[model samples]
Target: MQLDATDLKILQQLQADGRISNQELADKVFLSPSSCLRRVRMLEEAGIIHHYCAVIDAAAVGLEVDAFVQVTMRRDVEQWHENFSQALQQWPEVIGSYIITGDANYLLRVRARNLKHYSTFVLERLYKTTGVLDIRSNIVLQTLKDTQQIATSLLVAE
Candidate 1:
């Protein structure tokens, strides 16, 4: 809905720390706790605040490798798209998937334990999926920056 300066502030604070208590969030936004909670609830109701989750370290949790996979569909059919999308939803290795432009029809962010595991996933699972024409993967050498935070600059004019 209509987000004012205070709403933007609330969003920025929450983006930084989703675990912040309602009272703490209110203090940061300089609003009463009840008022701040109401705004948060409203944001959630309006779909601006989707869900809060913990961000875990992939490497620490046995997912040491990050891969960007480009998938090309065999046919430009509606059924093919639907089937592939559903398949991706069930696959745990895929953290993010986008129907993109350019040569590749879909781009997937995947995590694996190592290169051998990634190879097995590619050869056994992704390649065997229906309507998969070609699959290209780019392994991340070094991750400079990775965060789920939404840019607040878009909501504010400089």
Candidate 2:
């Protein structure tokens, strides 16, 4: 779908506040309520606006340890990759997982209560997963920036 400047503005407003009322959103984007609603519905139908969710704080919820784990696989097989992907979905500690072009096959963002809990997950669960050859982890000491918002202004430029 071809998104215009108005669509970009609407997206930016939504990204800032997903729960903003249709009337408020329409005012912000300088459109009628019905038009704004129609545009938003179109964006949703196009899968541009995937889903609305509340962002939670990990530390406030007793999750103190955040680690970036690099996993190397024993075999470069499609089935092994599929199995590993399925296994990740079952592990709640893993918040994010990605297949990247690097020494590791997968990179996982894990959240735990503490270092001990993180270690336990790595030792018991991650290591035991089939085709897992090696694992490296870097625990985050401080989080400088973390956000789900995408730059809609860039979309306008495109």
Q: Pick the candidate with the highest lDDT.
A: 2
Query: In candidate 2, what are the lDDT values of residues 1-158, reduced to their tens digit?
Result: 99998999999999999999999999999999999999999999999999999988999999999999999998866689989999999999999999988899899999999989998999999999999999999999899999989998667652
Q: What is the C-alpha lDDT of each candidate?
A: 0.93, 0.94
Candidate 2 runs further than 4 Å off: 76-78
lDDT, candidate 1, 1-158, per-residue tens: 87899999999999999999999999999999999999999999999999999999999999988999999998956699999999889888999999999999999999999999988889988999888999999999999999888888797666
lDDT, residue 133, candidate 1: 94
Q: Deviation in angstroms for 38 in model 1?
A: 0.7
Model 2 has an lDDT value of: 0.94
